[model samples]
Target: MDIEQIRKRAQEIWEAEGRPEGQHERHWQQAEQELSGGGELPQTSSPAHHSATTIPEGRGKKKSDAVPSLGGEPGGFQPGELASKKK
Candidate 1:
């Protein structure tokens, strides 16, 4: 994508992230994904634009500490948790 488009998207992400620090890479990737319409990105917050981490923006590790679920409970979880049978 062009620099301007990417820049705009990145800025949006950064803003959604509460203007956090040191998350340039993450923000950039997220912006790219959204702009490119890559679809739901794993380990990424939905366009709801909220980071799982509640530690505020500029502390450290700007992205949410919570694990991003494609469609399950948020936060840490085991693989087997997705098992779909009860035998």
Candidate 2:
């Protein structure tokens, strides 16, 4: 039901079909299709979703330990709140 599960399942299917290298896009698409019961998964926003860091700014760099700069942003937002709000 999660992205990893979907990805693993997709990889298995892709390999079963014929483990052709460089077909990552096809594997992901097929995986999303199967996971969504033929409906489209929300199109991937970017490669950030699959990378180690959630932020796209630092793709291969180590995350800094410095204090985060919220820059006058409002507080009281809990984890998953923003995503839940969208639903």
Candidate 3:
């Protein structure tokens, strides 16, 4: 998402959460999730993705794990690419 979208979503989250303290980053993260289409449906996969957690039936919304940086990609990376590459 862009700066404007992130800022807008972050503000929305901050306000929704009653404006808690020490959670600016968290709010920003949730904002990205919101503006970046976090709630979009994910396709069911094969056994490899079996272990992946699925959102509950009534709780299909996806939440962001962390806040992206102000600029650039915010350090996006795969968790197990090295191990898989060696195989």
Candidate 4:
């Protein structure tokens, strides 16, 4: 790919990461990999242009179905029971 494109993408990746210190090489390599079709790069956008369109449906909804009930006991253990039982 183009060196200029890699440079631009690296700059974007650096900025998107909050401009951390001492990460130039890492960002450059990541940009190169993404540009070379190694992986998809995260999309960056201005706050004004960011909207719900970028988020999937039920993005903020709590997924109760994914959680299993523990019968009101934390970790499914009684208050005085040992965390690990001996054989």
Candidate 5:
């Protein structure tokens, strides 16, 4: 029927398909197809908001070695020491 109706249908299909990984393209294309009504949806050159490869795998590639420490350990913050300064 209308664009909203078609998009709703396509979204339902996308959700039904196990919400599979790397399915953003499929979702966008299907949404356009369902909403286009035989006329092509105007294409935009703007980059897609969500990129598939950006999803990190595993616990995060092992961090490639420990992260550079910000400062000293957590206990370095002496409790109430900063609060004393305000008074």
Candidate 6:
């Protein structure tokens, strides 16, 4: 991948998203994805959706819910269990 092309595309993405702060990595990844012909990035309807902390309605889970396991287990393991198992 061309660094210059990626930089230009990232700048375009940054400008298109109103130049929000602290999103350099995301913009760079998106630019790379586009330049590599992976697929077009999904367009957001509003600039507010660009905030990293803004979880969309109906998409977030309650804190009480079990986080799903990567191994396709029924009930997920506790937070520290995965690392313990690895060791």
Instruction: Indicate which candidate wins on lDDT.
Output: 6
Tens-digit lDDT string for candidate 5 (1-87) = 576776676666566664555755766676667566657543332233335436565756553344443335643433335534534
Write model 4 residue lDDT over 6-62, tens digit each, in one string: 999989887986676777887888888988998775544334345534768867676
Error of 3 at 76 (Å): 69
Which residue segments of model 1 deviate by more than 4 Å? 41-87
Q: Which residue pairs collide in model 6, if any?
A: none
In the order shown, what is each candidate's alpha-carbon RMSD? Answer: 15.0, 14.9, 21.7, 12.8, 11.5, 14.0
Candidate 6 or 3, higher TM-score? 6
lDDT of candidate 1 over 60-81, digit per residue (tens): 7554456443434444344345
Give per-candidate clash totals. Answer: 1, 0, 0, 0, 0, 0
Q: Candidate 1 local accuracy as lDDT? A: 0.65
Top-TM-score structure, candidate number:
6
Ranking by lDDT: 6, 4, 1, 2, 3, 5
User: How well is each residue in 1-87 modelled by candidate 6, as lDDT tens digits?
Assistant: 999999998888888877878888888888888899987763432356556668798776665356544445544455557655654
In model 3, the worst 10-residue window by lDDT is 40-49
Ten residues in sequence with the least summed lDDT for candidate 2:
41-50
Off by over 4 Å in 3: 40-87
- Give lDDT per model, in order: 0.65, 0.62, 0.59, 0.70, 0.54, 0.72
Clash pairs, model 1 backbone = 53-64
lDDT of 3 by residue, 1-87 (tens): 599889976777666655666777866776777677899432223233344566558673654446433333344445434534534
Error of 6 at 15 (Å): 0.3
What TM-score do all the candidates reach, one by one? Answer: 0.45, 0.39, 0.42, 0.46, 0.31, 0.49
* Deviation (Å) of 25 in candidate 1: 0.5
